[model samples]
Target: MKILKFISVLAILVILVFSFWIYRSLNAPYSHNKNNQYIQIPQGSSPGQILVKLTSEGIISSPIPLKIYLKITGTGKEMQAGEYLFNSPITPLEVLSELKSGKLRTVKLTIPEGFTRFDIAKRITGQFPQNQAAGEDAVLKLTEDISLIKDIAPQAKNLEGYMYPNTYNFPRAVTTQAIIKQMVEEFKKVWKPEYADRASELKLKPHQIITIASLVETESRLDEERPVIASVIYNRLKKGMPLGIDQTAVYIAKMENRWDGVINKSDLESNSPYNTRKIIGLPPGPISSVSESSIKAALYPATTNYIYYVLNVDKEDKSHRFYSTAAEFERGKAAYQTWLKKERK
Candidate 1:
């Protein structure tokens, strides 16, 4: 009876010691030397391999305790693979939770509204250089794929005005093609079915609406003035008059690979269909990416007799002054030219 009692006490002490060890292994904080350094666990890596890599990189002190805990919890199979940045003084349990969630490091890329496809391509190439040395020109070619939006805008020559402009976060290994697809998908998401119905009510196609929206986006920065500017475009189109928007001339210059930041006389004289100064209608396609506000403005232009507008130089917000008569337009032009001269000086 005495020997049996001693064995029983020993068994109880052993259980208490093992339980204490397991609790400390999971809950205790371990400060390591590797903090803020990214460690990539390749795809298909086993849990044992992950633990070994982490332990070897000084991200953790030992793998034995974690291994035992993982076995007890039946969670070894749930570990995922991705780029991880572990902080110092982290518990083993916390690390396992992070691994199970598969959180990855990401980089941000921002495309502002009204950016042209060329501008977008340059930004993409600069943010994510090609591993195969396929330069910026190659990235531009990726934008040329029209199949992505064929169902929405079959007449679109390229994704000029369709790539929605916004900030995006992506993994470091993301491809440029994937980035472009995501932007287009975002644009599709913003374009609602009611917008298409509105286009039909205005006797316009989706392509034409997008083109007009692009023009409105580039013309005015103020949301209040966008609908007004859109009205001017509509008025000009109705009267069979040249739009005379200098931005179209700029877009032509860019298409010809000759944009020098200066609108030369030759640019205005160029007979390209996109040169609104020479053309009497909307451009063949969109010149820049369109914003939702600009699209709404195109669909719902305010009712007005105004057919002309010039920069409202008196206002610092780059607003415009509308005019119904050529005489009034000429006066506004004179005032704008005066302001331009003063700004140049």
Candidate 2:
């Protein structure tokens, strides 16, 4: 009887010690460092494989305790596969919860208003290594799929202005074509059917309206000023005068792959149709990605005879002064030139 009692006591003590160890392992934070950590749980990874990965990534001190705990809790088969981002010093329970949630990691990409396809391509290529391997030229070539916007912009050479500017979440392994397709789809969603009628009223095609909107987007930063700027563009087009927008010169530089963010004298004198300084009418295509407000401004221009505008030097903001006559325009231009010289100095 004494021997049996001693054996029972020994067994109970071992069970208690084991249970305490399991509890501590489950609740204790496990990480090599306090910095943010990321792990990729490839598709179709088994629970054992996932635990091994966690151990290899230094996310867990040891997988044995976690494996035992998961098995005991009947959650061993609950782990899902995807890339996971974790902050260090996270508990095993938290890590398990994250894996089960299956919220794979994504790249947050922001395409700002007035970004050109070149700009967007550069951003996409730089953000995703999978895309970078394909090269920026390959990404830009993907945007040339005219079928993406054929219904809306029948005359469009490519999906330039139609790539609506917005924040997008792309997976790590996303392709360039998928990114452009989604952006074009987003543009389609914002384009109302009534805009087609408005374009017709302006005697402009959808592509032409987008081209004008791109001009407005690049020309002015103020929302209220967009309509007036659009009016200026229209008035100039109607009067058979050069638009004289410096941004168009910038656009010409981008097209010739010589854009260095500075508009030189030669760029202004370039004979490219995109150079509004030398061109008589609208450009052959959109110059940059446009926003809805810019598009609306293009569709509904303000009633004004103003044909020229210069940056307002007096204001701290990026505002402009509009003028109808050449003399008034020259005055504003002179003021701008003086300010530019002072700034350069």
Candidate 3:
């Protein structure tokens, strides 16, 4: 009986040692020296399916060992779904824990091109609204309360064009006014010394240049065409002619809350000094915030004796045809009319 008991004990000890060795071999840390790879666990993938995928991709050696480890570690129920990039050799337990944490992938928020001040304000406001800051109108409204920026653009009645459009990475916790200040600071940073020299050469104040640039920015989508439009404005200025910019009249109509979709004869004849038809030499201030290309256009206008331009409506493109005389302008206008009739048809 004693001999039998001793043999049984020895067999039990050997089995225990071998079991430990097997566990260690199966659950060893994974080594991935290649480029960091994205691992996607589809939503609703069972633990068994996940294990198979991990084993096939060399992310793990075995699923059974991982299951035991997870049961011991108490992190089995916390797994989340999303794209994840594994950077280096790590135990299966570590990767599982990381997926469970569900940390977000920080990304940049990009603002699209050709957005106006109202558009900018609406965008910012939508992100952080009045209720976010004690009944204030928007994130931009918080800027108005800051005394320092109130006088930033004296000519601009409100913070319309000052909010420069660009991509920004705003974390979830950022405050209302801080966002506005960031945009203003960004604009100032981009406004260079060369721009100031160019402004001086064109006999325009920085503020005035911004206004015209805003107009040019709104006028055309093509960067190449801004200089030509700038020349048209300058030619009109030299000839003591009314800018005849329907946009300006439309601006006034919008301000008065009486815009009837189009600028009628009476709208252009309004008594405001801002009415370019009544008083020439660029309105009292810039109508809107301008862009870099428009600023360049304002600085360097095209050299042309042409005094008039009408849309090349005959062509599929919306570009204008420049004319040196009223007769030529009339001919171009007639062609535009013919094209307009066909388009309507």
Model 2: residues >4 Å from true position, as ranges?
A: 1-35, 56-78
Q: Which candidate is the best by TM-score?
A: 1
The residue pairs found clashing in candidate 2 are none
Q: Per-prediction TM-score, please?
A: 0.96, 0.84, 0.63
In model 3, the runs with Cα more than 4 Å from the true position are 1-114, 127-156, 256-269
Per-model C-alpha lDDT, please?
A: 0.90, 0.89, 0.67
- Rank order (by lDDT, best first): 1, 2, 3
Better of 2 and 3 by lDDT: 2
Ranking by TM-score: 1, 2, 3
Error of 2 at 172 (Å): 3.0
lDDT of 2 by residue, 1-345 (tens): 999999999999999999999889889987666246567888888889999988888888889888998888899778898877877788888889888888777899999999999899899999999877778888889889999898998888888898889999988788788889999999999899999998998788999999999999999999999999999999989999988888888877877788998889999888888888777899999999999999999999999999988999999889999998999989999999999999999
lDDT of 1 by residue, 101-173 (tens): 8877787999988899988887887877552487777888889999999988998889999999899998888
> Which candidate tops lDDT?
1
- Per-residue lDDT, model 2, residue 75, is 91
